[model samples]
Target chain A: MPDTPFIDDGSNVPLSELRWPDDDLTRIPDWIYTSDEVFQRERERIFFGESWCFVALEAEIPEPGSFKRSYVGDVPVIVTRDEDGDIHVFENRCAHRGAEFCRALRGKAENFTCPYHQWMYDLKGKLMAVPFRRGDHGEGGMPKDFKLEDHNPKSLNVTTRHGVVFASFSESVESLEEYLGPENLEQFDVVFKGRKLKILGFYKNRLQGNWKLYHENLKDPYHATLLHVYLATFRLMVAGQKSAMICDESGRHSTMASAKDDNIEIGEETASQMKSAFREGMELNDPDFLNYVQEFDSPWTVTMQIIWPNLVVQRELNTLGIRHIVPRGPHALDMYWTMFGYEDDTPELERQRMKQGNLMGPSGYLGVDDNEAIKYLQDGFKHSHSQEGIVKLEPEKEGSTETLISEASVRALYRHYRQVMDI
Target chain B: MASTHPAGTNLSPEEARALRFEIEEFNTEYARILDEQDIDFWPDFFTADGFYRVTAKENHDEGLPVGLVWCDGRPMMQDRAAAVKTTMVHAPRYLRHYNSNVRVTGVDTDGTIHSESNYLVIETLMEQESRIFQAGLYIDQFVREDGVLRLKARDCIYDSLLIPNDMVYPV
Candidate 1:
């Protein structure tokens, strides 16, 4: 590893200069993680392209006139419910001057009034009023042909599945159900299942790494058994557990799932392989922390769904959350977490969910490992002259796998990524 | 909900001042333990049934039930301490905790004290400049265990909406 001083400006490497190291997905070029040109291209071809990005949960803005500030990739947007109880997603930029008008994270309002010029827009993002349309005292009035509707702010194609909200810049994008194929949809529904969601709260943290690394982290289960000693030591998701890394037809989305088996002992060979991660005699003083209430109908106790480009639906035991990945340039990304429970949950169940929440988040037992690892990875890519990352765990496998020791799902993600990015 | 403290037991000015002094002293020691990164001893500052949580003021003001670190009991805190010490992987760093403005609000009939204080935690990583990691207010409920003040509950409500990377250590 050469400790070369790498300049991050887009000028260092042209987009045309970048190419795959090999014709296969086993070798991932480091430029994809550290190049500014690649990040800009991702914003265009992936985030603001044809993909549907998860913006907000319907539960966040449940009532009419409720609104929450959100993002599609790096572009700020507002997710709102209008007077008609219809959900809408539109740019937070004011139609008149492009100032980010909505500042509060979440609130209820009849309409939004831009503080810059008092240009008012209805909840549906239609320009309803212009303070100087006729000009104050008729001095600087707009042209006679200016129409209020013509000046409306940009809006995205909005769709909802169960309680999750997704938005796309492309008007002709596929439906949300079709976007998440049948296999992925089945696993998605296992957690959603039409039950009203109760918002527990939120956790926001910025990880100093490429946004794609977050998706890859969830898709790569090999690291789960090796990097996170807490998870492996407790057998929440050890290597020998019943698990599957199931990918969608397009290879863009996947679900890394595992069923917790308390009585099933780890085989000797597997235990030896995971010796560094598993502690011989460690135990939680409160054994109830790892208790599985068995609330869902699915067999897997943990199903971490990497839904294409921006969403991660986490069903880790009883703790349920949606992680929205907001890319910030190439070196940093903001992770917004929305933790929830069903509306009809008993007080005890809600508390249990909160207790279980300790396993994930910026400060969680397992989550801290991933965040730190991502930071270290970004540091490695930024400072080192190394140009390739190896993903050849199971050389012959590509899509789904029954073994946790494979990087098949990671390879599958890049297979779709290369096509979508046209690299 | 009615007040858990009994009415008409308002403390004298001298008693309130003395209680505030005790709380200030207790917080100074608490901050020292965390600043030194002696996480294994972190659980001992709390009562057996102690509750600890670290949440953003946005969520705390909205009465949200979630926490970045929600531990319902001292056992859970012990688990977190043990894991942070033995299992979790993070960059080497130093943290300095500044706790001030201790105010004792009330004392229940059982001598449990309600208090609030402002805190600032500055972190310095290897080869990096020190920065304010978290600035928060700690809302606490304290009780005497064998004549020493121990926390019954400590709600660390952070004012920073976006954590820098991750809170590797508890504040």
Candidate 2:
């Protein structure tokens, strides 16, 4: 691809070349919060330019002929598995007109037929047929040189790791392994775990906040304790404790982790309720509350995997899930949360997983609060008050363990986001 | 004219009007409890083991089997109250609930009664520039027991799906 004027050096110069202060940290300007111009630039530069977004898990379209319509940063994409079990992703728009061809959320289809004009496309995005194209005599007919093969939906470069599929609009994007980096791949392993997953269900939430707020919410270690106290009550996560706000070199991938605090002594009332609820309460109701069962090889009680712009692989207890933040508008974002478990999970374990799942999803103990806060954050941005916001909690080291109440991870996100959006 | 009244069932036309007024008052009081953040008193609007669910209409319509917030029993509700009051850190704001169109649908045996009403809630946050956070309707189901009407279920059907911020309180 030829270089665009702004990206001549193969680097996002708008942000990186700025004569910023020599200090290691800086507060992000608030205009990015409620600015329409910033969003449009982001759409062109980052979302449509050079990023391999995780579109769908291979488990979603398990059998051959299964297809699902999704998006990569507001651009419509159709992901399908052909009879040969090969997964392919292509633009969802029809060749004749720019109408969305795949209307259904998901289904098993050999070929897709456009509703507007009777144009047909195969699962591999090949233009199969057009109605009335072979007419014997007609005043209005196809041009003699019209070629169907030339109008096939353009396919994107794809890569898969542990049944997780990713696609890139740019051919220059590094391999999926390198793009995700070693630290990120390790986090992916925590949820994917090299096992066939069972998609329990999907939960969608429309939040009136900037897409950046959702990213910062997950990365910020400051809010978990105060915003979601239900976790604290159950000794799941406690604020003001030893924790890590981790970020990679590029500041894209991040993890907000905390050690299981053993100091939470279970109350008699809570213990009694747990004992009565479970017939065989092995470690379900640990009196000490610090019983980290070592479900994964990691040390964190919960780690919110900030996968670049959209994906967040949340390992919350036994009920593992992924949250994809689809940007709807400058003030709105849709959270598509997919909850999953291993194929061999037992009934009792499944029940526990569902109950624990309540701690995260839309109705979850934490998720709703996050949603409410996001709304307020947007409402605040609509004012003429402040221009710059601070994220200087851990100025010394970008990825160091600290007291749970720190926003270092959020700072890392803004730093990387500024680079990607080039504002 | 030979007029006969049913035994132990005596009420004048004006008395019926007074009963309607009392029911409306009871409903408004429940809303007051929530508006004031008096969550401890809010549970009094339900029975000990009554179910509570605050869900989006989309999920409810599709039988999507999920809610923004779901409390199977009052114990869970109480637990949420305990958590939010102490541990949930969020921006301080006010929720104003306005209820009207109260209708007494039917009378139940044992003096219990079923009723329905409509409501609107306006939320305002106290930032430097006070802003209108959200506005939505509240679909409520009520039951009268022991000479008092209590809320059975309160489904907050927000017309706007995009919430302004993190919802820190029970609607």
- Name the regions of candidate 1 deviating beyond 4 angstroms: A1-11, B1-9
Residues B1-171 of candidate 1: C-alpha lDDT, one tens digit per residue: 264433333666667778889988888888898989999999999999999999999999999989999999899999999989999988999999999887777789988988888999999988567888999999999999889999999999999989989998889
lDDT of 1 at B129: 76
Name the candidate that leads on TM-score.
1
Error of 1 at A57 (Å): 1.0
- The clash number for model 2 is 15
Q: What is the TM-score of chain A in candidate 2?
A: 0.86
DockQ of 2: 0.17
- Worst ten-residue run, lDDT, model 2 chain A? A277-286
Best by lDDT: 1
| TM-score for predicted model 2 compared with the true structure | 0.73
Please give, for residues A1-423, the per-residue lDDT of candidate 1 as tens digits.
222234552225667978898677999888898788888899999999889999999999999999999999999999999998999999999988899999999999999999999999999999999977887786898998999989888999998889889999998788878888899999999988869999999989999889999989988899999899988788888877799988888889999999988876877787799877888679889899988888898989999999988999999999999999999988899999999999999998898899999999999899999999998998888776757889999988898899998998889889889998888
lDDT of 2 at A150: 87
TM-score of each: 0.96, 0.73
